[model samples]
Target chain A: MKIHEYQSKRVFAKYGVPIPNGKIAIAPKEAYDIAKDLGGKVIVKSQVLVGGRGKAGGVKLAKTPEEAEELAAKILGMKIKGLTVRKVLIDEASNIKSEIYLGITNDREKRMPVMMVSAEGGVEIEEVARVSPEKILKVHINPLLGLQGYQIRDIAASIELPRKNWKEFGVIAKGLWDAYNGSDATLAEINPLIITEEETMLAVDGKMLIDDSALFRHHDLAEMRDLDTEAESETIAREHDLAYIQLDGEIGCMVNGAGLAMTTMDIVTLFGGTAANFLDIGGGANAKKVGAAFRIILSDSNVKAVLINIFGGITRCDEVAKGILEAIEEVKPKVPMVVRLVGTNAEEGRALLADADMITAETLAEAARKVVAVAKEA
Target chain B: MSILINKDTRLLVQGITGNEGLFHSQQMAAYGTNIVAGVTPGKGGEWVMDGKVPVFDSVKIAAEATGANTSVIFVPARFAADAIFEAADAGIELIVCITEGVPVKDMMRVRAYIDQLDTRLLGPNCPGILTPGVAKVGIIPGDIAIPGNVGAVSRSGTLTYEVLYALKQKGMGASTCVGIGGDPVNGTNFIDVLAMFEDDPATDKIVMLGEIGGTDEEKAAEFIATKMTKPVAAFIAGQTAPPGKRMGHAGAIIQSGSGKASDKIKALEKAGVRVAKHPEELPDLFG
Candidate 1:
């Protein structure tokens, strides 16, 4: 659910947060045109949904329009942490006098949204937390009461922000909070909320991660889903309302629950086999959903074998077994397949799958061992 | 004998007209849960399950009319927050929400609002509670669970079922099994349920199934060491999962180099809780 810096800035601007004038460019020519309009001096930031873009050389300053094109071309061609920079944000460069960190995120321990402020900025907040914990001041916002003026003042004073900027700082803080709650964002951050040469604050960089469950409400935000950042199988799984995470390995894991799916992956690794992906068909899955999940698992070329594990509670094992059989009949998969069915009519499920050309195990450990051996042989 | 529900638990089903609600309601009643009434807006005059359970327009009316003390919610994610609020306002003592995919922000408010009320909330995405052979609430399949003195708690549903099946294989049953749900923000935590288990006379040993995410497990470890007298065994899933990738569960992610399985296991082991290396090995640590 991570959005690019430009998209976050868009959300921030909508909430009255001060942000530098910027435009998105998918090409070097667009970057050149944007730079020319922005007074020929701008920052070309790669719009990938990852942190440490500057350290990874995905961020660069262009002194001229031509240089902007050159830097954009270089950044667009580069990959940071394996994600290709498909676009760049050409922003009006700021003469930053000082930088500060301001952000809002869920504090799991407090079970509330916490606003954090620090004198140190333009760097990873986690690093500041680890190295100098005292530098960061935090305030937990009650969901009912929201970010109060007193809390804002407490943050500003604790961070030693000057009185002249307090009013603007409060505005930015409230806007950040709005952007966070309004967009259903799990995190809304502005690193390097810069004090410019003019002494006015401007957000130089932004990051936002929207909550996946809340995407149903924010249809506009849901369209911001970047398919380029996801595996094709993952997108397909999401479409089917199944949870799937691609991984390296040969055994394609299709399980009932999330925790059990992960545990199945671990057990696969423990048995000297690796899982190609983690696929949870979810609870109460009927034959059709199970079939869809099975096909998604087989979509991966890395898969040498398929392991279907179901500890049915809400999900009936017989339906899962029927889906697997239907999937095998349709796909006619060449890879070896192993099935483990237990709980909630598992006997009927196993009986239904007994005639299939697949290995069966009564337990997860047995299934992992058999699947790994069969995959190695296959 | 159980921490949450027993024979005295008169249950009301919110969203009872829906598929998941009606289905689990029937399953729960078949398991000997006291069937009282149901709540589905605009369907007040109807009776479901062969006219045995009457339907009401709202939780307030359902609670007032049926004298139901507890409620299990099966509404969709969009209406789940309001459902919890309605159930809470109705003065239901214990509310178990079975709806998955509730927005975290809604839960934030729900959690805050419920904190003010004298009520105990369990999973919005969880399988709820199963007090073996007495009363079954939520979606935890009752047939697999047997009546015994062992207490079990988990942040997962089917994984906990796997552990329970493994325990049952060794002739071990549970006094009560609670799934706290897998969301980062939930109504209850390991410590809340663990404290109840520690105080319950029917419970002997405790088994906790946790995953990588928040420090709930670590804090529970500290609580187990400092507060509890009963022996505790635990398992932390997602050990092999890569960092920053959510392993199906919304809360099951290793973020900011924290919530790693190694860290949780190290803390739990240091606190003298026998941490299982694998799910199958969990029952061996029950002693």
Candidate 2:
């Protein structure tokens, strides 16, 4: 749900927010062409999902088109937080008079959406909070009433903006809030909203996290999801309709619920084992779902053993046991499995698995230890 | 006494016609929950689960006809936020959305709307709350929980069961166990549930289960340090998880400088909440 700076700026421009003229290029030659077209100084920034690119040398200012090409060459394919720079945004550099931070997010304490502004921009908000908490100004919006003109003015004043620029700041703040609400964004931020030496306001950088649940309302935004940035196992899990996260351990876990998955992983580690992944088969672990789960875990070559933990209430333990037996037949995993079935129909489920010569534990702790031991042996 | 639901709490199941909805509804009904009605857009006026509960097209009509004040949603992720809002508008006091994959943006709006209303939402992607030996409003196994004085709150649903099992082995029981869900922007936070646990006289010691994500755990640590007086023991998961990667839960990601397991553990330790280095040490912390 993270969009690149160039993409975010496109959305911002739609809301009438002024953004620096920029063009994205996938190749160094294309970056040089764009830089030559813009003329004068241009800033070449790596197109990655993470921040701190500037400090990491992924961002560079070029005085000439050849330099821009060189900077783009250095930035292209550069890894920032595991995400490779596939493209670069080349834009005409702005002369900054002042920089400010503006963002909107849910303030849990006040139980309302809050707009945060700080005079010190272009830095992580956490750093600002840790250093000078008082520098950050907050304005809570009443959900029923929405953001109002006065609220924007209050934020503008809190940032200590000069009277001449107050009207322009208010207008920009209102537009940003509108775009945030319209896009169904959980977080819409403009770090370093700069005032140029020419007395023009422009959004130099933008970041947005769209709410995934609201994709139904905004089909246009849903298309922006970049699957390449996600883990391979995660994308496959989603396709299979299983909740999975690949980890760097040996014991592969298949638990019935989210909480159980975490505890299963915890207990596995406690017993001197490392978990390979966190896989929640959800409440009803049917044969198909269990089969999918097996395929996911077996796909991980690091998996030394598998643990099937189910506390079935609505999900009949007997049904889960059947699914495990069926999945074992389909996957034919070489690794040993430690199965624990509790709650509704647990005895019957255990009876089904008891005939399979599979390792079974009467309790979760016991099962976790057994799985860990089996993994260590493997 | 339980905190959220009991025998007297009437329940309405949303997305009743769906596969998950029907399955969990039957389970809740079997557990003695007063499941009076169900809501499905086109399946209204139909019968499901041996025709025990009437099905309605909308939450508003269902709430009016059945007088159901609580709702459990099994709607798909795409429609979850709207379902929550519909239930909230219908005057449902509590809504437990069992649906997962709800976009964080939708929940942000839904949560904000829920905040405006008097209703409380449990999860957009969680294994709902359970008041053991009374009524089960969520998908958790009712039999695993034994009603008593120990209160449990966790981000992980199955982990909550493990904690309950650990406590049960020690002959202790739960007053109320709530899974606040693992979504980044959820309706109820750890501090909100922790405050409720602190106020409940029936609850004595509190067992908190957290994961690496956001500043929620750190906020809970701050609350525990300054607010609550009851004994608290906590366990944080994803210790072995790689940095800058999301775990199973969408909200469970380590976004750059936020929500590290080691940081949260250190924060909790500083705040007087007994940090369990391992899951096996939970029982000892309570003792």
Candidate 3:
């Protein structure tokens, strides 16, 4: 789950990371008060979950409280990256001397948590990786031993930090790692960890992405989830305990397992078909789950056909067939459907489904072909 | 002849007292898995599932009493990392986490810890691994799997089943099929599984199921291009997925041109992996 920059900064500040004083505002008046409290010069930033807000005119500098209010007003109702700015963060402006970047994330290849630091900050790290790959420094932490003083020093030196600031940098790096580990964050990044004219380091921008699976242990962090920004279907699916993802194609896919769902779509496309959505009813393809899946698919107007593929193991094919029949009755599926039932009691499932208008295939390949044909006919 | 597991592998269930944990644990046991013990915090000394397997409070105790080397986790996402670490610390050789919604950061830390140890971690958000006609260590339906020569790997669970069903239609079955989970930073990648399948004598052909998101597919394609010797048939879902929208899989999002179905298909095709344009074409490619 991604938190807004302001929220991330709040968490960072709690960890003793220095950040410019900031207050979140939901209205222009609130922005004005925050700006006035910050002594007039402040940065107004839109509170969106995505990046490139600056390029999208979501971030603006204000010299006066009135300008801050004006900027806030302009941003409050504006849409950046499909999310309207409902709130703005007003932070005290600081004199910048130099900018640096620091972040912690899992390095898949190394199969370890890696801390990344660069002397150059205030820009996207991907650009840094592509343009000047040498500028970035990476340090992998030993999970058993945790981050040590030497590891931090090595990263600090690799980033070419001055000897005078090495100790402070080390301290900040260790703190960041601690926060990352403590919070169960997948990524904790401070883009543009600026050195102020006063020679003090401050995290000017903060971004954090927490792992959703870990939310069970961290109720405090889980409460920070912004449901409003998430997709309506995804939120509802979670409530139903169904694995659903809305896609853009015209064919709705309902399958029993993950790998099979991908292959079903792959076959659909191979047969000149476009899948509208990816729905996995999991191993529990009961009448209710199948009914819910049907409703979710019908919700998408783009859907022209529905593909139901089941490879029953613990999930009996006959039970899945009952679910499909019950769902068709409940949803009155307007679109065409291609059904494939394999494994346990498949023949019984096929016999039960045989009476319906739905097309049936013995194999997933045939099912995909049938669905593609149905979609083309539609 | 399977990649990671067979009928002889003894299984331990972590968080066995929970609804999903107990439900899938029973199903796995019924399917002939040697479920040695179950672990639930403070729920020790009670047998979950008709007193068949002893339930303990810790992985160490469960391992010591049962001599189980592999663990299947049904713990909630929050405690999943701790469960994985516990299993790893207990010297379990393979850990398959069936928990979903674990924060990517936690998995990274857990994965980092697992890397330091000799244990191989499957997922914090994945379905777990299934060796056909042998041991099923995840939440996937056991009936769909049949012991054969085709090796399947996928990021989506339901989708993985579709591929297996398609393969079964062509008189082919999986030696071992693994669902690596659909997360941005998963413990095992397609390349990792592909390498395993390549080395396994039982696996003849490999079917790779990928989705849009991240550069994992591109990396896998690069590896397949250079290292793989077996015939590989690949399929990428979410081709019709709207840009910027995340599919059912959280990691199945198309972002900034890096992880798109088209990009993945191109990369895989360039790597000499047989690309299936539609699910129906999969069987033809194998033939």
Candidate 4:
């Protein structure tokens, strides 16, 4: 999960990383007041869950309070990468003597949480890693023996940092490690760890990505889940223990496994139909969950037809058939539905659904084609 | 001969008192895998069946008592890594993990710790292996597999079943099928299983299934191109998947401008492997 810049900075502060003082404001006037209180030039950054905000003109610097208000007004309702800016963070501007980069993330090759440091900063780190790959230094920290002294010294010398700044850099590195480890963050990054003219270090910008699988252990961080960024069907699907992703199309798809769900959607597209959403009822499905899944699919405004595909392995097709019948009783959907049941007890399940108003197909490809044709006619 | 498990395979079921453990243990035993013992921590000196499958408190005692060679885990994700550590410490040769949602960090540490040992771990969130008509380990349906010569490896569970069903419909059967789980980091990779399949003389053809995440497929493609002479056909799912969205599997996302279906397909085709456009199209290309 992606957190707002302000929230990430708050988490960073707890680890003794120096971040600029900032206040979140929902209105232009509030932004101006916060900037005025800071008593110097402040930066107003739009708070959204997407990247490339600066390129989208969601970031602005103001010399005076009135200018701050003007910039905030322009940014408040502005859309960056399809997300509306709900709030603006007004932070005290720091004087930058130089810029550097630091972050920790999992390296698939090493299967360890690797820390990366680079002297070139304030740009897309990916771009830097692509162009001048030699400038970046990476250290893979063993989770057993985390953030070792040798790793810190190795990275500092590799990046050619001045001897005086080595101590401060080490502190920031340790702080970032603690925040990342303590918060269950998949990614903890500071693109521009700036050294100011006052000879002090500050984390100029911050980004953190939390691990969803580890959310149950971090109760407080899970509370920070942003509902506005998610579709209603997605939120409801999670509540019902289903995996749902909204897509553009008329045929609504509900399938059993994650891989089969994607293949179902792909085949639908191959047959020239678009899926309204991708919903996987998951492994062990009962009548209640299946009924809930049907309701969620029907809730989509674009859906003209629904396709239910189940290749039951451990899951009995007859049990899924009961769920479909229960869903038909509850939703009574006006949209056309094409049901395909295969695998364990699939014969009994297909027999059970035979009396329903929905259409049935034996093969997955044939079922996908049937749904597209029904949707096109509708 | 099968690549992973066969008729002589002695099996130990971890977390055997749980629902999944009990159901799959019976299934494996019924499918002809030698069910030796079970481990449930506190259920030592107990029995799962009418003493057909004995229960031990730890894997060490179970290994010593039953002389079990391989173990399958069905524990919850919170304690899965510890279960792996326990089974490894007991010197289980091969470990198959069926639990999903294990934290990547925990697996990272687990992978590192297991590196120094002699154990090969399969899935933290995977369906176990099936040496068809001989031994069935985890959740893959044993009925669909008829025990022929084709070898299979995949990243998804039910989809693996779907592909096997498709092959079975065409009167083709598999020597062995392995589900390596769909996480970013795993213990055994495509290369590990592919090399085994290549060396097995019973296997005449190979079916490799991949999704749109990670460079595992690309690496496998390279291996297939330069190393193997066996007839290989491949299928990659998630062709219509949008960028930066994970399609249910934790490792199924297309992140950082990599792991696209088109790129993987292109690499495989260039490697001279017959790539199936759809799952149903795989049977025609298998020959």
Q: What is each candidate's DockQ, to 2 decimals?
A: 0.81, 0.43, 0.44, 0.70
Off by over 4 Å in 4: A27-33, A64-74
Docking class of 3: acceptable
TM-score of each: 0.97, 0.86, 0.85, 0.96
- What's the lDDT for residue B31 in model 2? 82
Indicate the TM-score of model 4: 0.96
Sort by lDDT, top down from the best: 1, 4, 2, 3
Q: Once superposed on the true structure, which residue ranges of model 2 sit more than 4 Å away at CA?
A: A80-82, A108-111, A314-332, A344-358, B41-44, B103-120, B129-133, B146-153, B165-176, B184-246, B250-287
Worst 10 residues of 2 chain A by lDDT: A105-114
- Tens-digit lDDT track of model 4 for A114-194: 999988878899988888988888889998778987788888898887888889888889999999988878899997899
Residue A259, model 3: Cα distance from true site in angstroms: 3.1
Best by TM-score: 1
Judged by TM-score relative to the true structure, which candidate is superior, 2 or 3?
2
Which ten residues in a row are the worst by lDDT in model 3 chain A?
A257-266
Give the per-residue lDDT digits (tens) of candidate 3, residues A77-119. Answer: 8998888888899999999999999999766445567888888
**i-RMS for every candidate:** 0.9, 3.4, 3.7, 1.1
lDDT string, candidate 2, B1-287, tens digits:
66887777989999989888988888788888889999999888998888778999999999999999999999888788789989999999999988888866566567666777789999877788878778888888777778889889988777777778777778788988998898887889899999999999889999999998788999999999999999999999877666665566877877656778889999999999898866656878976
State which docking tier applies to candidate 1: high
